[model samples]
Target: MKFTKETRNAGRGRRDLLSVAGAALATGLAGCSGALERDGDGNGNENEDGNDGDSDSGSDGDSTDAAELRETLAAADPYRMHQYGPSHVGNAGGAGPTSDVDAVWTFREGADDSHYEIGTPAVVDGTVYVPENHSVGDDGAETVVYALDGATGEIEWEWTYPRGTAFGSTVVAEGAVVLGLGGSVVALEADAGTERWRLERDFSDAVTVADGTVYAINTTYADPPTLVAIDLETGRERWTEPLADERMFWPTPPAVADGTVYQGGVELTALSTADGERLWSKDFGNAVTGPPTVTDDACYVPLGDGTVAALESDGTLRWRQSVERGGRGSGLHPVSSPAVADGTLYVTSAWRLTALDADDGAQRWTTETAGDRPPVVADGVVYASGLNVMEAYDGAEGDRLWRYETDASSSSGDKVAPVVGETAFFPSAGLHALRGADATSD
Candidate 1:
């Protein structure tokens, strides 16, 4: 899809201007409120000195001034993926907005066209990154990646590829944005839209990065599939391992935790992240729908037959539960991955959001909704997107808190999982920036 910059509305009233500024400031503060440091392993965590190693405020004090916090937040780009990490746990970690939310901005492209599709966006620093695909006459389709101001909905930079379509979500890692284009994995400079490097391969899923390495899957209809790893910094080939002898179709992205890379297709496969060696594999006799959610002790795989299997880290089966059994004869199972937070697993089946005990696979609660995208958890609340509304519920009890109507269609197959920072970011027809109704009052 080709995108041209649209003019920004300059007729906003004083109250609207203040609202945008306040939302931006809140987003900055929220980014700074977390542990922004990266340890020696490059995973984000506090340093041994009990301070955020990435903080520029230094060891002089724990409190940071507003100016320094804003700068730090803008540079950190906290929430950048679908579920906040490669595991697809969908937890935002810190506090998120709780009160009723109002739209701060809406960004749209080709507003009159109905044939274009927008992929899920990645939010970092203060910018929203989105990829759009549209058909081009009788030839192939085109894909365009865009960066928009998170607060104001203004385009910052956009790059179009004339030959390929980007169907998977984008990943932002180590100062660059990585995505799959046709038969290649391309990395672009996040700030300038300049090409860093491209690795040619038939990538079937989105790219996942961990400990400085990029992991992706390559598949063909009649050929064996392979799991390939590349160095994120240089885009150099690291290792490749044949996944299976049979044809693997629509492989889910690999989730790396500890030292194991978990991928699911016809079965669940675990491989060593060091050399792409297969450690273990299990056949559920059913196709695994989405990427497996990994934790320190267990791996959760969602199946196409409405069953969720919890396996031990070493590939032992813990338990399996059928959360949704073709609700009302619809014969639809969950295609979205499960999100884990506070010892609870959140998943969507048919038209309901179900929460289960992560350890024992026990049902906790279920709430009726209109859509089936995975749910996101932050600060003891779960945010889910229904047909045309986003709803927030208390995490522990599944009690509804508030719902905000949206203009975007939730049935587009482009799952809309809200990205939480100081405010909640939702993407549909366009991107929407929202803040809690009680934010200013608090």
Candidate 2:
């Protein structure tokens, strides 16, 4: 469903705005609240440090293995639900809007003379790419994607896509921005903000980018729906393949792994990334809305009716677990995609954050977040967000660690992720950064 300010009960008038802004500002300040107090050993050696090394090194391993794992997890673009990635890292991660104690950065559009509520923002390199729009539709209004310095939130450049809403969250690859809108895919220069190429095809589905390729699903009224791939550097069509069957609306992107792209249309299909050739497809008899998580052995797909299924790379069903019983509990719809870390698969239903055995699909534990954002796991902890709550859980046993409350109904976009850092960076709900408390003993 479309989002409307009028539908929100955040309250109206000046008082509400100030309350929201002040709270947001306070949260942003926490971004740079301070270093995580560490033991004098210099190694993240505190019992609490888990794999302790240094305050930074312990948790922030720049090792080849860790980096490769990070690259693999982010490989399929976990931010397929929101516009931005895990968190603005490097310079952008250190930028002022994010470098304070509890700093909060909100995603807004160009409204009135100064204010606007907008869609997701895409972070590329050291800049944050935001959209300024008048409305959403083919002839609704035009959208301009602006590249802002992550540190100063300064606009470095902007690219406008005529006749498109700039509504979907964007992905980056090979120094180019790939966005889905106006029934098409558009690419822009990372530095100059110039349009490099565009493919017009109405897409309500989100997209993912990897290894210089783009994958997106499109739903139409008359024509059958399709999943298309385009060259990252140029918007030229690499291939356009029909979804498992016609009339299926894929709201999410496809996952890429082991040289094959995994997407759940009417069925989950493993397509050869090199040429968009279908290697195999698996049907679960349930409609899937987002990208499946592909590991070395399995693909995790979340279905719309309230279930998640595991399939092998060859289109064979391994196991299936129901996300919600039959009736609607709290999460009216399970919009967030599944996130895998270590050996568990984290999934969000309308009412809970659940951990499942990656190998067997058995329940491990469940939290009460009914998350709309993908959960992030680090140091044996799992983080998730919902309408008004952000929570951290023990990854091993699913124990509640801590819970923070935001304003009522303040949720980030569907694609947002809990960015791991010395402090967890909550970029959604505008932009709030929560710092980790001093580490005690394990």
Candidate 3:
């Protein structure tokens, strides 16, 4: 069904039913971290208003149990549509790969030849899921999604779709792997590489699955694009809403938290997760270049003007921070989504990674980095990818920990932010697995 601006609230009955289901699923699948400590410190205590603190901080009276937190971290899905849940915060919850890491294994597709390209991989429950594109014959290309063992870098199973292209990263949800292929969305059993369901449509961007529903944007670079909702299990269309006529140069997928879906395009729009009702809309006057990162209290959007704007849950503007990039115009501004952890917001712009206080938008620290992909935070380290190198920084102090060179070229155009689990996975020309230097002895 199509929803327009006037009839947006037509499906109140169905939306009310979905609201209950969405709430329950959200509580269960919500990322472990949300609030930043009120004192602007990395403490794990709640404030006077009952806002919880950072999960990584060891403060007194924190509700998250240590053992439970560890289990969640161990099973963390690193690339769940922009690194750890629909918020795109890039916070990995528990400890990430340490500074002392060595390449454990490198999996190169079609190593004998040179036509294969692997997209950014998703990690969940000790497995790395990746979609690969390679030439099938002379004129056709094939896309295959492969599940690799996270520890040994071995392929467990692979599902191939002939004569298609998978443009974005893979998402693991509900014990299945979902991705967009050409104009369709396909789900595969995460373990056995069996096809669960496939929905035929025009989805040109990555898919975000949360609260038992999958959110996608069906755009063909034409007017009147659509925001669609599909059943996470059956691949059935729940609702479809027409977006504004503004064309998007890049795909800004929707991020979900607390029963609300935040999407970025010509403007930042908030819609109900239950149905496609337009709750609110805000125009930043500049193109929103990346998907928003949602927390308990605020949603963060990265704009093309080197500014990160934070909004309250009701779509009110909280604060906006502009990172000065010498004299370069907005065109050169980094499009990386902001990553929040330990009460700090980490964003990359103008070849630098800047950390800001999540509460007041105060600048905490800034360090030089390369590339435009969002940084991932785990344990106490921040992982960022630059032209051809992936570097880790001290999460608390913003100190350079170590760097790993992925290719010899200075500008490899590799934008894969390292995904950390038991091991750190980096995707460039191929996938490289690294472990802590001390892991060998242990």
User: What digit string (tens of lDDT, one per residue) describes model 2 on residues 156-221?
Assistant: 887776633324566656777777655567778777888888776565435777777777765443
lDDT at 248, model 3: 43
Once fitted onto the true fold, the runs of candidate 1 whose alpha carbons sit more than 4 angstroms away are 1-77, 109-112, 134-141, 325-330, 409-414, 438-442
| Lowest-sum lDDT 10-residue window in model 1 | 51-60
Q: For candidate 1, give the lDDT of residue 83.
A: 74
Model 3 per-residue lDDT tens digits across residues 185-225: 88888879999899876665457889879888776443677
Global Cα lDDT for candidate 2? 0.50
* lDDT to native, each model: 0.64, 0.50, 0.63
Please say which candidate is ahead in lDDT: 2 or 3.
3
Q: Which candidate has the top score in lDDT?
A: 1
In model 3, the worst 10-residue window by lDDT is 1-10
**All candidates: TM-score:** 0.78, 0.68, 0.78
Task: Identify the runs in model 3 with alpha carbons over 4 angstroms from their true place.
Answer: 1-79, 109-115, 164-166, 246-249, 326-331, 408-418
Q: List the residue pairs that clash in candidate 1.
A: 1-142, 77-125, 100-437
| Per-residue lDDT of model 1, residues 31-140, tens digit only | 11212222233221223542110112111232232234334336642666657777777887666667666554555543233344566677778677877665555545
Q: Which should have the higher TM-score, number 2 or number 3? A: 3
